[model samples]
Target: MHLNYLANIGRYIPEVILVLLMVGLIILEATYKEDEKNRKYIFIATLVGLVATLGALIANMSGKAEAIFSNSIIIDQFSTLIKMVMVLGTLAAIYLSRFSKDIYESLKTEFAIMAVGILIGGFLLASANNMLTFYLGIETLSILSYVMAALKKNDQRSSEAGLKYALYGGISAGLMLFGMSHIFGVLGTIQFAGVAKMIPTLTSAQLAILMPSFVLLFAGIGYKIASVPFHMWSPDVYEGSPTPVTTFFAIVPKLAGIAALIRITAVFFVVDSPMKIGWIGLLIVISALTMTVGNVTAIGQKSVKRMLAYSSISHAGIMLAGIVVINDVGIRSVVFYGITYLFMTLVAFYITSIVQDKYGNDHFDRFSGLIYRYPFMAVMMAVVMFSLTGLPPLAGFVAKYNIISSLINSKNYALAIVLGLNSVVSAYYYLKIVRLMTLKPQESNEEIEGFGFLNQMVIVSMTVPVFVLGIFWETIMNLAAGAKLFIQ
Candidate 1:
């Protein structure tokens, strides 16, 4: 438990502040009428949330990896960096959620508590070194996500999204649990680093069992990250849930899941023998298929929300390209691309959230003539879309360049070419959004107000990270190339 205290007050600094602030707001509201007096509380909570998270991240950078709670949990640079991203993304989601008044007032306490609970899970995932710890983290995030998706009790779509996510998520968890049992049987240990050390000695028969277990484990991770074959849930969930919650799904959950995957696969996956050949080949095939299918199908989507959903899947494939290399560059590229992916996607979703909130529709055609309706939003949306397309001068392309260049250097140019061509294919649909907004005229001819100040808050805050990170990516690339949580 002392390990928890090293960052101690610093460890959950964000969670503690958010929870306490949320409690204060609820208690104050108990004594007051239904006035809009508590708006200040939410804004202050947002500020504290961001500050505490950033502070903890900075603090963690100076510390060594330590296992708290009798070695069940571990903290280091990798966990710290991933946690920083999750906290920042969650804060952005909270910021974009400023307009959700009724949901905010009615469920203020629950929302805050659940959000902190989810953060705890995300933190646990980052630091998780053992099977029990990983399971605990994944369950915590999943349960809270279900509740969040269902927060709109009056909306049937929200309820349906919750039901489907819970059902699919539960099955994935079960599969993972089954795989853990096999892993334990083969190695007599569930601690990942321990398993990695022991895995090198296992017999061919043991490797046979391990391979399927790997797939089952990958299924659970893929569902969480919305990777292909397990991505059936994303579009429905994204399109059905309220925009704010959907935005949350887009940002933090995806990052946490992917980061966890990188950590586990990089360390614990034992590729020791010829029998283990199957898993690597399987991953390579999945990596190719995920990129090709996600990009190809996304082109036909009419809803911008669903398009982004599929776009995320395609990007996941690109991230997996880094996974294929399995070296310093692969690891760093995952982190680097993960960084770029979060800001680009979150800002794009933020723009869509604001537009949908203002217009009461999210259809692709509705985006037509948006440049005429609100020029600022149109420009911001275009930046986000361009970034997502992996275009030059944006962080997305830089992310792709690093990953593909690394893969090619690793003598995997076939996969690199696939990734490159997919990027080109993806550009068509992403720019299609821009063309619609700029070229087509508004269908109704009735005017919509320029985004109000509150909405602009969401747009401007998300937009800065998307563009600035693209220009100054070198420092991050350097950091990522050298990042190793277990070492200095």
Candidate 2:
């Protein structure tokens, strides 16, 4: 029995490494004076630790799938792939925090600490096989996020953002728990497998009770992904938080939520029943609304961060569209979309962060005539924008294409059409930056010091994948195809 537990621990090394890394950072942070601006060792240590965690996840990818820790968690390629994406997102955000001027120098270390802690939660949530572990994961991710959002203690907007996040999170958590309790009461077990076993056999009375319970349960996951209705806080929080934090939010928690949602849809709805019909109907409505609402609202946003915030919400809707198909192809498409999204989002935010640091704001005008000053960055931004709009021969196009194809294969024509229309609507805002960068005059002749050679190289390198993945996506699609959920 003890040997079995020890083996489970072996499979869980990535999260363990992160926990140890967080503690080490705390101790290292204390050794420095409070006012010290540069903490190079802390940065170095964080990078090394994250790299190690990524390596562990890569190693885990080839292993067999199994439920561990008393079957509360499952280790599988799907969860492992999502974890890798989250780790990569964290790594980028940490690097960005190292130089971003928005965050207080003293608070930078705290950001790294909180980020890793949230990542641990994300890992748990991605693989959670039961309601108990699922709720624990959501709370862990939420509490740290509240602190990270309000990271700029002196900034009133940041404080408001944090408070709003906390209040909403508390309500969402409570409702999710309430729903979970009813589920337990009806099914007599918190285990997801047990719930699945009971779902197909449910009587009409039980189905009535379970349907609403499932909707309530979705509230928690939906909030995390920033889907429509539950997405009220996303733009405000994204705008109010530091750019690095915003970047992290766009990638990690959102993908983690999608991963969990995919698992639930695949597991609970695998067997055909009336409950499956209700769930799919709910996803279809939410997916269309989320996509339309996000795109329509983004058209008027002036702040680049806020625009991206809505953009992310819309992107989440697209990912949800992938889940609506409820098949291996849908799952693979969502995974591929996530991989491409991580790169595009990171590059966009990295450039935006650097530009904001230079200009003291992320307004659209800040990018005016960027091509004249930094043509390479201007082109990179243009490419990402085009890709974001689902243009041809770019990663975003392929990602969107995969999802639409999957939907079409499944005859989900309406949602696919909604996704297509949303992409057109998105072009207005995404291309707005492109037009400003190329058509407008330079804001100033002064060079943005943030675009130093090394930083420029890093941005360019990140953008490389945006192009490569678009053309050579088959390799990645195969990898994504292998990320199957372990259903027991």
Candidate 3:
């Protein structure tokens, strides 16, 4: 038992570090006075911890798979890749928080603590091999998300956002737990591998119970990914939350949710399962609607942040299309797209926060003549927007191409068409942001100030990868190819 416990600890070093970091942050936050200096320390500590966690995760990665903690957690290249995404996302978010006007001194330590808490949840979700751990991971992430949304205590919009998120999250959680009960009733096991083993033996009556269970479970997962019909809370929450929190929402939870979804789908919807076709059909419809709604609605939004909220929904749909293929290649594409999206979305939100800080709003008009005032930032924003639009020679284009190609390979023609049309439709709005920055004339003589040195460094660090990876697609693609969740 002693050897077993040590083995688990050795295998879970990254998670151990995260646990220590979260506990330390909480203690520090409690012990320290509310002041800017302490807040700065909190921020710096959070960044350093996240960076260390990332290093630990990379160090722990392996081509082989292992089940740790009595098989509640699975460590492999796939989970490692997903955790990397989460750590990187959190790091970007922590750095970005330094610039938020809404996150004052009093909130800073709590903000770092909550972000670390969410990162812990993210790491768990990525490695979860049992249903109980999965649910716990999600609940930890979701509860923190609600509090983060409402951090702007004085703002009515922020309060409303938190309330909406809580209500929606509650319904989703209930559905998931109920579904778990049904699944447990039928299969007598909550471990994914156990469930997968029993799938072939399920009677018709058992399958009827199981199919609904999967759908119910997807309701919770769908809510996390912000898929259609489950995405209504995201835009409002994104618009109302502190900018840094909004960035965290856009990246971290999405990565964890998608990782969990990929695991669930790979386990339950393998080729020989009787319910595979039914689940695929349902995902198809959901994916189509999600992309359509996200793109079409974004066109009407004047606020860039709100529009990106919708855009995120669309991107979720596109990523979902990769899962529909249900092959290792398909999973690889999803992982690659996810990595690309982390950089793209973070840089986009970083710019939005800067714009909001300078102009007091994130509206289209506020972005006018940004080229004349801050040429470097304008170009960077342009790269982000163009990349988001899936324009050629950009990473977004590569990601879209990979997803679409995977769908085509799987003969999901209808979803491929929807994805294509939505991509084209999305260009209009993305370019609208670009056009507002470049073609429109300045409405005032005051120069739009650029971000401070550290902020610029952070944004550039994320931005350069989007451009470099776009040109050198094979590197990430090769890395993603090894990130398959299941082996034949």
Candidate 4:
């Protein structure tokens, strides 16, 4: 029990940061003299918070998996890698807190505080070892995310998007809770291995009472991941929220959701039974349709944020492919895909933030002459788009290769074909954005003023992973393979 408690220390540190940040926010609210120009403090404080969390996580890394709180929470290489990525991702998102439109007064600190809360929850979800732990982690995230999405409370569009999200989020939570009750009632325990171990022994009637509930639980997790058939709220939220906030939605939160998906299914629900294998098939279909639709719909989108939101949903499909396989290959590929995903989406959205700052344009037409004014930024943006399209010599392509090879090795050829075809289709639209940036002519001097120094710093930091990881792809692959989530 003492060792178990010590094992959970990594998971506890992020939450401790959340508490400290909340304390800071309260103190700031009382003492801060609001000067609109002095927003740099917010950036400095947030950067400190995230970097500190990263430092704590780095101190906790090891090759072993350990559990705490009676084995309801786990700390392992899988969760460690995810926690590090999320901390960095959240840090990158908060780097723009100074320029955020919603942080007009004391609220600057609140956004940072709320972001810390979200990070805590996401970390918890990554380490959860039971239904109870999963629900607790997800709700912490969901509660903070609701406030974050609707942070611009004065904006009617933000409020409207919040309402839709609240409705859906509430329903999903209730359904998930109910499912947990059913699982516990049928199996007599909520611990992951407890339920998994009992699965084969259950009588037909018992499984009938629980399997549907199990499916419902997956639905709730899937909603968070924004897979197809339950992905309705994302586009509206992404469109209505600020671009920086939208960037958070595109990267950090989705990584957490995928983490939860991996934990819930890859660790707990896996088996060779036909019924269990059918669930994997469900993932295959969900992944294929989600990716194809996202790529197909992005071509018609005028708003770049909306395009990226759909693009994120599609990539969720690719990540889902990793989870569906339920093996060492799948786990490694998923982690690798996530690392590449951060590079692809972060740089892409960083470009969006830059374009919006310069040209005051979110439309494709505004980017027509971006290359001429900011040639470097334009080229970087084009490379990011190509990587998202899964082209060669980019991290995204390497990620796709790993997933496809894992699928084929797992004998999932039909689904692999679906994944392959969607990658081809996505290239068309990703390149379309490139054409608008380069081949199209600038009708005005919009992009010339878009040199946001803060955004430039963020974009450059985000862009490095794509190239470095592409050149040294083997290193990441080896690390992912070496760090198994459940084999022990």
Candidate 5:
């Protein structure tokens, strides 16, 4: 028993380091005064911890799959990859917040602590194998997100974003728990492995109970991924939250949420299972609706932040189509898409944050004459826009290609076509910003601030990946293919 315990500890070293970092940050915050010097130290400390966590994750990826703590969680390649993605997203967010004009400087330690909390929750969600652990992870992420959304305390919109998020999150959580109860009642087990074991034996009546239970559980996942019906709060929250927090919201939570959903879906709805057809059909419909709503609505949005918020919904729908495939190819596409998305989305938000810093608003008009003012910055933004529009030789194009191909391979042609059309629809809005940046003259020749050397390095780092990955995507595709779930 002691040996097993030690082994589990060794297996989860990365997660352990993350938890320790969280505690360490809290202690540092408590001891240090709220001042610039201390905030800088806290930021540095956070970055060091994040880098250490990443190292630990890479070191531990060679181990064989195994469930720890009575199958509450399973440490494997799937969890390792997703956890790394979450950490990377958090790192970007922390740095961005350190430089952001909107987030209060005094709250640096608190922000780092909360971000670490979300990171830990993401780690938990990625490895969860039982209903109890799943709910714990989801709530950990959701609750911290509410606080993060309200981090801009003086802003009324931020407060409203937090409140709206809390209300929506509460409803989603309640429904998820209710669904878990029904599932446990029907199958007499809470572990995903147990669900699989009992699925074939289920009667028609039990399947009936299961279907609604699944839908209810999906509501919680849907809310996290921000699908069409459950996506109402995202635009408001994304617009109101500090830019760094908004970027975090756009990237990390969606990845964790989808990772958890993929785990659940793989366990319960295998290719040959009777349950497969029902969930796939539902997913297809959701995918189509989410894509259409997200792209169509983004075209009319005046706020750049809100428009990106809608764009995130469209991305979610595309990834959801991959989920419906219920195969290794689908999982690979999702993972690859996830990696590409991390870069493009961060760059987009980074640019938005810089523009907001300069003009005091994130309107498209703020970016007028960007090319003439800052040629490098303008070109980088253009690359981001084109990639998002899924034009060739950019990572977003490759990501979208894999997704659509996965859909076609699964015979989900209609959804694949919807995804393709949505890409075309999406180009109008993405390019609209490009047009404003290049064609429209600025209202004045006033100089813009921000985009310092460090910020430029950050932007270039993210931008280069979007371009490089488009040319050489095999490495990421292989990594994604290798990170398949243990169950499948």
Candidate 6:
């Protein structure tokens, strides 16, 4: 028994490493003087630690799936892949925070610390095998996020964002707990596998009870993914938070929530039941509404950051579309979409953050005549925008294509059509930046300090993946094909 637990630790190394890293950063941070501006050592340590965590996840990928720590968590390719995506997103955010003026210099180290802590929560959520671990993961991710959102000490918007996030989060958590308790009371177990076992055997009366309980349960996950109705806070929070924190919020929590949602859908809905039917119906409505609401809302946004926030809500809707199909193909498509999304989102935010840092806001006009001063960056942003619009021969196209194809294969034609229409609607705002960058006259000839040669190279490096993944996506699709949920 002892040896088995020790062996499970091997599968858990990545998370352990991150916890240690967070603690080490805290200690290292204290050693520095309060007024120290250049915390190069902290930056170096953070990068090194994140890289090591990525390495650990890569190593875990090769191992067979297992229910570790007495099945409280399941380490599988699906969860591990999502963890890798989250880690990469974190890496990019940390690097961005290093130079971003949006966050206070003193709080930068704190950002790294909290990011790792949230990442740990994401890891737990991704692999969670039971209700206890699942709720714990959500709370852990939420608590840290509230602080990160308000990192700008003097900014009232930041404070408001944090407060709003906390209030909404508290409500969601409470509702989710209420749902979980009802589930536990009715089913007599908090273990997901046990719940699955009881689901198909549910009486009609029990089904009626569980249905609403599950909807309440979805409130928590849906809030995390920023899906509709529960997505009210996303834009305000995104606009109010530091850009780097917004970037992190876009990638990590959203992906983590999607991963958890996928697992719950796949595990609990496998056996046909009235509950499955109800759940699928609910997802279909939410998916369509989320996509429609997000795209329509994004069309009028002037702030590039807030626009991207609505856009992310729409993207979450697309990912939810993948889950609607409820098969290996759907899961594979979602995973592939997630991988491509990381690169596209990172590049877009990096450019936006850099531009915002220079101009004090991420208004659409800030990008006007960008090609005149910084052609490379303007082109990179254009590429990201095109990809985001689901234009051909780019990663976003392939990602969208995969999901549509999966939906078609499943005869889920209605949602697929909705996804298609949303992409078209998205083009207006996404291409708005492109038009501004190319067609408008230059805002200024002054060079953006954020677009230094090294930073441009980094942006280019990230953009290359967008192109490569579009044309050469088969390799990744194959990898995603292997990322199946391991249900016990």
Clashing pairs in 1: 5-8
TM-score of each: 0.91, 0.98, 0.96, 0.94, 0.97, 0.98
Q: Which one wins on lDDT?
A: 6
Whole-model Cα lDDT of every candidate shown, in order: 0.76, 0.93, 0.86, 0.79, 0.88, 0.94
lDDT of 4: 0.79
Kindly provide the TM-score of model 3 when superposed on the true structure, using C-alpha atoms.
0.96
> Which lDDT tens digits does candidate 1 get at residues 459-481?
67777876677888888667655
The regions of model 3 sitting more than 4 angstroms off are 1-3, 35-38, 479-488
Higher-TM-score candidate among 2 and 5? 2
| Residues 285-390, model 4: lDDT tens digits | 8888888878888879998888888889899989998888888788788888898888788788777776666555577776786788888788889989989988
C-alpha RMSD (angstroms) for model 1: 2.9
lDDT of 2 by residue, 1-488 (tens): 43487767879999899999999999999999989988999999999999999999999988889899888899998899899999999999999999899899999999999999999999999999999999999999999999999999999999999999999999988988999999999999999999988988999999888889999999999999999989999999999999999999999999999999998899888899999999999999999999999999999999999999999999999999999998888888898899999999999999999999999999999999999999999999999999999998999999999999999999999999999989999999999999999999998999999999999999999999999999999886776555554444
The residue ranges of model 1 lying beyond 4 angstroms of the native Cα positions read 1-39, 100-105, 269-277, 444-450, 479-488
Per-residue lDDT of model 6, residues 1-488, tens digit only: 43487757889999999999999999999999998999999999999999999999999998888887767899988899899999999999999999999999999999999999999999999999999999999999999999999989799999999999999999999999999999999999988999999999999899889999999999999999999989999999999999999999999999999999999999999999999999999999999999999999999999999999999999999999999999888988898899899999999999999999999999999999999999999999999999999998999999999999999999999999999999999999999999999999987888799999999999999999999999989887786565554434
lDDT, ranked from best to worst: 6, 2, 5, 3, 4, 1
TM-score of 5: 0.97
Task: Give lDDT tens digits, candidate 3, residues 32-101.
Answer: 7655364666676777788888888888775468887777888888888889888888887877776677
RMSD of each: 2.9, 1.2, 1.7, 2.2, 1.6, 1.2
Query: In candidate 5, residue 6 scores what lDDT?
Result: 70
Per-residue error for 101 in candidate 4, Å, reads 4.5
